[model samples]
Target chain A: MNDFLFRLFRNGETRLHELNYLFWECTTRCNLHCRHCGSDCTMGSRDKDMPLEDFLGALDTIPESHRPKGFTVVLTGGEPLLRPDITTIGREIKKRGFGWSMVSNGYFYDEKMHHLLMGAGMGALTISLDGLEDSHDWMRGHAGSFQRTVRAIKTASAQRGLNFDVVTCVNKRNIRELEEIHSTLESLGTPQWRLFTIIPIGRAASDPDMILSKEEMTRLMEFIALKRKNPSGKMVTTFSCEGYLGKWESQVRDTPFFCHAGINIASVLIDGRINACPNIDRDAFSEGNIYSDNFYEVWMNGFKRFRDRDWAKRGICTQCKQFRNCLGGGMHNWHGACEEPLTCHYSLLNAE
Target chain B: MKFFRNILKGAALTTALFVFQACYGTGPDFDPGIEMSFHVVSKQTGEAIPDITIMTRGGSESKWFEVGKTDSQGFAKIYGLDYKHNGIDFKFEGKGVTPKDTLINDFSKNFHEIRL
Candidate 1:
């Protein structure tokens, strides 16, 4: 009995030795094309669906030992749900005993679709909602996307089995509506909310005006401070106060965690391509085809490239103090190179 | 000699198990029923104002409670509030001041104050 117990504990520790995460871009096709979207995701894109065989083959390559204990697979896309075989992909992931999560625009929710996904062991569904009805619709470039998203949230929330979270991208257009968006979420009773800063790339590059200015970010942080002080704050807690504070450059220096991505978290693309993090693109780092190569080989080769200081030679990423923490400034925002360090207006406001 | 080595290994393992269990067992021993007093004051006048209401939200149950009025000095003390965490928010209101507004939130020590 003593020998058996000792081996069991030892094996458990050894199983969790490697830090791993997978981001599966099931499709690049999106229903709504938002103005500030860094991906430039649109309904017209030809390369939409990822072949199911390729996806499953990629999963088979990840050895059971190196597979993380609570192995997290994030299914993202132009819109992952738009793919025909998303539910099948979800089921396959669950069969391998891995946790499944998704990032969607929330326009594809229906009674049948919701049940299929929840049945497939979908752990969490993160939906995008830019602002209140008019503001959100305008930002998404669809007249009724806001209403559809609200209905989808209501539908998803009504389904007791489904876990849903709302993600709002803060930019110049909808910066003022932060409080209103919070109130809307409160009214809907959504459990979790995440506020992400916009990365400049794709359409965002053409319209520099869309990006949030330094002054706006400062005001937004002040409002968040006030909300924290409020006793009746109804915002559902998904992330910690410390986590939110680190998003600001001024507070980031004090935070102990330099980069949680590529170590604790990672992003896998649809074409058997894997990235070190979700916020980066596949072309940035294609270590090897996931179908042909094992995770160990790909991870080691890709991680070296990811950790490369060539960004310093490029002159954009090297000079920035927040480089260690920022982790290549979110993959979608990588637009070749500009003279600037791709600093978010929010960080610049607090920058010394 | 083999039997003796196995016995030594077992003893070391037992000691490590006990140490792990002890570390996990030691945690905060909090009394849920115990309540404390909260005070609110104006930063400008340093005078305790009357008709300010305070409430607690988020937890098992949401409860609303009234605090005391200020004396000569701008200080009102409200009691019988239990908090699981140190940081608790209190909303304050007066005739001229904004109603349903957050007053006190930061709680480093036991005695917490809201300066409007």
Candidate 2:
């Protein structure tokens, strides 16, 4: 109750005036090749790494009006940990009196990285963990990736101040092992597990095999429901609209800023180009380059394109009973998840 | 102590089971068994946080649930909670606020402070 209450009422962690978050793709270099990677993070580099000075300069360009109180900066990538000077990056971000966090594949996380992040005053570490052992290794396309991820979890779990959470991207292949992974998370003393329905874009968009059928998604929702009802489960499960059906299905859509579609969030690619979201095609939606253009203008203009979507002609979103509740589910999520009329998953579940 | 400063907001937010309630009633919907009261306040300003919704899913029925909004003193009394049979899983959301908080502490403790 204390933690939940804190999350509900607190505003200092969320100053009204400050820019909430900035998702910067630190680098495109990664060691693993996950089949469903939206960013297509490869073991080889795109050679589009943002220099430290350039990143800092762009950050500095953020007008003071945007950040009455310093904003949070989430360093992400094909694998942010791949950067040799990640600690220095963390330190520099912290020096500005702003929150610092990283989203990584957990391949490079070890005692050394832990020390560096802790010293640099990192606020959180969101590591990707899709499944248990064989399933995880299969998804990552590496033999020993599972063991390394376990090591990373253990290291992260032991940290006194540094916060950590597991991000499991759900897809067709590894959906069955979710319960087993949850059990493992509990045994390992993991605080939480983030279950994300895989979004089809980038590498995933090119492959039709990655998207989950409506039936598969329904089954997944049932599984999540049963898990939440269980009394002994320690880890909290945050399901998407498919998982938590009903009126709350619109909670995400109504709260636009929290999602990628909202103007508050922006993604910087490894090449310094900006996109509304990392999952979207960079070439097509590259809002502007962070190097040459101002970051604020690019974000406002690029996100306006999404905010002004035409739900009028776009799918079931136009006539659904709950059309007013969720504006076409959301521009990016609708585009990435569906090719047909965007029917409300909740409405379908209710009819059943 | 200011817990937000000590614990990461992301960690806390993810750990919470966020639920939004659109109705309120004390009729047959409640169990009249285990009851709990909560008071919410902002640590930064030391002021009560009113109109925050408090929700929980635990009771005698196969799928029992309860939801309510906080009063002016940031206080709300939740009744019909099946404390003996079900576990504690609550989500407290403030009105018009960007950040969402939940039952990360004991509601019976009377007062809880969140660093805003």
Clashing pairs in 1: A23-A268, A279-A330, A279-A331, A280-A331, B47-B74, B48-B74, B48-B75
Error of 2 at A119 (Å): 0.8
Off by over 4 Å in 1: A1-17, A158-163, A231-234, A237-258, A307-340, A344-347, B1-116
lDDT of 1: 0.55
Model 1 chain B poorest 10 in a row by lDDT: B20-29
Residue-by-residue lDDT tens digits, candidate 1, A1-352: 2334543433332232234346777777788878877667778776747687777776777778666444667777788888877766765676675667677788877544554455455666677888888889888999988888897776565543344567777778787887888887877777656565665666877876576666776776666555555624555422111122335433322112223334334455656666655445456555666666675566644565344434533345555565544434433344344334455432465466
Mark the 10 consecutive residues where model 1 chain A has the least summed lDDT: A237-246
Q: What is model 1's native contact fraction? A: 0.00
What are the chain A TM-scores for all the models, listed individually?
Answer: 0.81, 0.83
Each model's interface RMSD (Å)? 18.2, 19.2
Q: Evaluate all candidate structures by whole-model CA lDDT and list the values in order.
A: 0.55, 0.58
True contacts kept of each: 0.00, 0.00
Q: Weakest 10 consecutive residues, lDDT, candidate 2 chain A?
A: A251-260
CAPRI band of model 2?
incorrect
